[model samples]
Target: MKDLFCLIMAGGSGTRFWPWSRTVKPKQFFKIFNDESLIQSTISRFSTFISTENIYIVSNKSQSAVLEGQTSMLYRENLIYEPVGKNTLPCIGLAAMFAELENPEGIMVVSPSDHHIHNEKLFSETIHAAIIIALENEGIVTIGITPNSPATGYGYIQTAEDITGRNSIKQFKIKQFVENPTKSQQPVTLKREDFIGTAVYLFLKYRYFLNQ
Candidate 1:
């Protein structure tokens, strides 16, 4: 088995969920739906597949202390504190660098800490399959979540003809990257807008090599 490394992006302030999600405590730290916070839930879901030591939480410096107290399984060093938030690209780049340093052949899974997965088993199985595809193909692989609805709040990935299989890492030509709709309209209704980019990605071994 390849050495698996998980990077949980927990840097967002979650302005949409504001009032409750202040700068001091972002949405990831809030247990809005269940017993555990979003970050905790994300990490717990991956624990079944990867060891605690191999998991990493990349976030801004402000939330480091709070995050440290919340989860005992995560160590201080494992929590990477970035000076400032430069969005997903930079975050992924830093993670790739760390993954390369830790293990050149490591399979790194990068995902947001705030999102929830209804089907835990299926999600895990899919992620594992993606890692395999990434290692074999030696290219950047992103997992496009099976769209439950036409969600306007999230970006859509128009899959290319080459894509196949339920858990396969298929090539998806980056189509229109749409923003959250202004209001709940017709087909763009809140519920119908289900196909949102989960920001979940699997960086292949060679991709990791190049980034580092």
Candidate 2:
């Protein structure tokens, strides 16, 4: 069987949860809602589909000691130390580059280190579906969450068409990526189908670990 790799981006400064969330220790390594930390939960989430051996963490030099102390399951070799923070695009690109070099045909699962999923069962099922979709098609498959509100905090995706079917969820041809709008700019009557939220689960065809 081909390998499934998990790349965790944990280098964020975590400004949202400031004071508690430090530069040396981001929100990903802390647990406010659960006993296990956010990053720990993320690892557990992906570990169901792939082994810890295939799991990799990409963080900056600032958090090396904190990450080492907190993440016991993560191997020293698996911790990719990025010197500088360039943002998610560069971080993901670097992970993908390393993965492709390791195993071009492998399934690469890229996700943020910090996130709270209320629906664990549904999340797992959706990931499994994404892996299957990527494997069969041998391409990139991005997972977008079903929007529950019209809050302008998150960027929205305008769907060209709704390709939903019985039992299965709908797939859309992304018409445009809309930036966050102000409170007054928001739709007065909000509906579930108004927009698609970002869960940040990116499944790309590739494969492993390289500390930068």
Candidate 3:
């Protein structure tokens, strides 16, 4: 994992999970399942595979203390804060930029810092599978979870019907990115429309490496 870096994006105000999840204490720092926070669990899950030095926390200045307190294992230097929220793409771009500086042709595992996984074994295997795909190709490899029910809070990914891959991971060609649907649009049927769902794991292989 020399050129592979795990970039954890944790910079939301938790507006969606309001009241309980306030500005000072966002959902990322909340211990919903157990003693550890969501961000902590997210970092810990990848600790076994990715090195601490290569793991980065892209958060906001407001939640710096919370991030630091919750993630004791991560180094202070690895935390990158933003003055204002410019959304996910920019944050990912920032991490990619840093990764490029160190290693021009590198693979960055960009994921959310707030989410839960039922099976660690499967999750780890999926990530490694995505890593393998990323290292061997130029395209993006995303781990899209099939939603159990209608969810308006999370983003979704829609892939082509002709999914093909040797591994358990079925590689699908992403179609289009759709916006969050309202309550009226419940049970919205998706046909590679990239509907919003429970969660999505994005594995990006920077443009620098695409030429190869």
Candidate 4:
């Protein structure tokens, strides 16, 4: 796992969870289940495989105090802070730059800091599968959750006809993304091929090998 790096995005304001999760202390810092906070659990999940040195958390500079108090196990430098919350793409781009500086060929696995995944063993397997796919295909690989309902809140992923299967983990060629469709637009029962966008991504330093 020397070439594997994990980037956890923890900069969300948690405005959706207003009453409990404030700007001062977002939902990521809250201990939603058990003793560990959401962010802590997230870190722990990746720590099972990725070294502590390779796991980095990106959040707003304002949350430094809370982040420090919560995740003291991390290296001081690993806690990357943005001057302001520029949202997901910029946050990820910043971490990608950091990973590239450390190792140009490193495979960066990006995840959210607030997700609650129950099955740790399966989660690790899925991540490793995605990493293998990314390295073998030299492209971006994402984990898509099969949506059980026609939920309009989350974006939907449409996959192409082609499928790549390895070690029981199947990879699909993404056709397009349907962002938060209305009830009229979404089918009452989703097709087996469709999936909800979970934002979990694995890619090799923004395709660094392309330059070679």
**Candidate 4 residue pairs that clash:** none
Give the alpha-carbon lDDT of every model: 0.71, 0.74, 0.76, 0.79
> Which portions of model 1 miss their true places by more than 4 Å?
146-153, 165-199, 206-212
lDDT of 3 by residue, 19-106 (tens): 8897767898889999988998998888887888789888889887778888779888789887787988778787777777777877
Cα-based TM-score, every candidate = 0.80, 0.85, 0.88, 0.89
Instruction: State how far residue 39 of model 4 sits from its true place (Å).
Output: 0.6
- Better TM-score candidate (1, 4): 4
- Name the TM-score of candidate 1: 0.80
TM-score-wise, the better of 1 and 3 is: 3
lDDT of 4: 0.79
Clashing pairs in 1: 149-194, 150-192, 150-193, 150-194, 151-193, 151-194, 151-195
Model with the higher lDDT, candidate 1 or 4: 4
Q: lDDT tens string, model 4, 1-212? A: 88889999998887868889987789999998889999999999888889989889999878889999998889989999998788767787788787777777788888989988877778778888888877777656778887766777666777776576757766788877777788986673275455555555545555453343
| Model 2 CA RMSD to the hidden true structure, in angstroms | 3.8
